[model samples]
Target: MTRSLPLLAALLALVATTPLHAEGDPESGQRVFNQCRACHVIENDGRNGVGPNLHGVVGRRAASIGTFRYSANMRELGEQGLVWTEDNLRAYLANPKAVVPRGSMAFPGLRNPAQVEDVIAFLKSRAG
Candidate 1:
C-alpha cells in the first residue's frame, strides 16, 4: 500500500488541476456568434431576425421577448419560471430540444463544451 502512495498523490494533483469545463473566451465566442447571426442578433438596438434579438438574454426569462413569437413549449417553460442562468444556458445550448421539447429553435445544439462556455461568456458580456 505504501508503494502506491506517490502515484495516488500525483493522480489526485492532476485531477485537481484539470478543469471540468474550459474558462470561456468572449472573443472566441464572438466568432462563434456568427453561426447564430442568421437567426438571432445580440447588439443593443439590434432588430429581431428570424429569432428575437438577444441583447440582454443572460438573465432574461425564456420566451420573454415580446416582439418575437415563442412556441408553446418555450412559453410554458418561461411561465414555469425558467430563467436563462449560465448553467441553464449551458444545458439548453447543449440540447435545446431536450430543454424545451417541441420548441421552434431549428438549429441543432452546440456539441463542444468549450464553445458552449465561450458563447455563454459572450452572451453574459453583452447582457447589458
Candidate 2:
C-alpha cells in the first residue's frame, strides 16, 4: 500500500497539469453566449449591429464578410489563409490580442476555459 500511494499521487499530478482543450456543449455554449448578444449578434442575415454576426464564422474565411470592414491585422490573417480552426478559436478566446494583434475584436475574452470551449462548440455547429 505504501508503494502504491506514491504512484497514485504521481498519476493524479499528471492529470491535474494536463492542458484542457475546448470540447464545449453547443446548447450550453448558446446559453453562455447570451452575455455576448448585447454586443454581438450571431445570425447570418448581415444585420449590421454593433458587431458582426457569427453564424458561419468557424470555417468561413477571416475578414470575408463583405459588408463589415475588418481591421488591418484581421485582413492580413485572412490574406495569409488563416481559417478559424478549433484550436485557434480556443487560443483566440483565451486571448484575442495575442492571436490577432491589432485586430478590432475588443471582447475582453471569455474568462472561463470551459465557456470558451462551449462557445467554440456552438460556433462549430453553425459553421459551414
Candidate 3:
C-alpha cells in the first residue's frame, strides 16, 4: 500500500504539471487559424503578412524573424531567452500583453481556452 501511495503521488504530480492544451486538435486548430490569417501565415513558403511568418514559430524565440519588425517588448523578451514552448504559447494566445507586457499585438486575444489550444496545435502542425 505504501508503494502504491508513492506511485499515485507521482502520477498526480505528472498530471498536475502537464499543460492543459496537450490534446489540442490540429484540424480544429486549422479552422480556428482562419481568425489569425489576417496577420499571420503558416505555409512553408508563406510570406510575412502584417505579422511575421509562423512557419516554425512553435520552437522559435520571440521576435526572432529578421524581416518582420517586432515591438520592443517582444524583441526584449527574445533577447531574454523567451522560447515558444507550449506553456508560453498558451499564455500568449490567452493574452498577448500578459506575456509581453509592452507588446503591440492589436488582436485582443482568444477567450475560449479550447480555441487557444486549437491554434497552438495548428501552429505546431505547421512547424513540421
Give the candidate number with the greatest lDDT.
1
Write the number of the candidate with greater TM-score, choosing between 1 and 3: 1
TM-score of each: 0.87, 0.78, 0.83
- TM-score ranking of the models: 1, 3, 2
RMSD of each: 1.8, 3.5, 3.7
The Cα local distance difference test for each model comes to 0.90, 0.82, 0.89
Estimate candidate 1's alpha-carbon lDDT, on a 0 to 1 scale: 0.90
- Model 3 Cα shift for residue 122 (angstroms): 1.0
Local lDDT at 98 for model 1: 86
| Residue 43 lDDT in candidate 1 | 91
Q: Which numbered prediction scores highest in TM-score against the true structure?
A: 1
lDDT of 2 by residue, 1-128 (tens): 99999999999999898766636799999998897787677876747566668888787777787788788899999899888777787788889998898988778788888899889888878765
lDDT of 2: 0.82
Cα lDDT for residue 109, candidate 3? 86
Clashing pairs in 3: none
Q: Model 2 residue 59 lDDT?
A: 74
Give the candidates in order of lDDT, highest first.
1, 3, 2
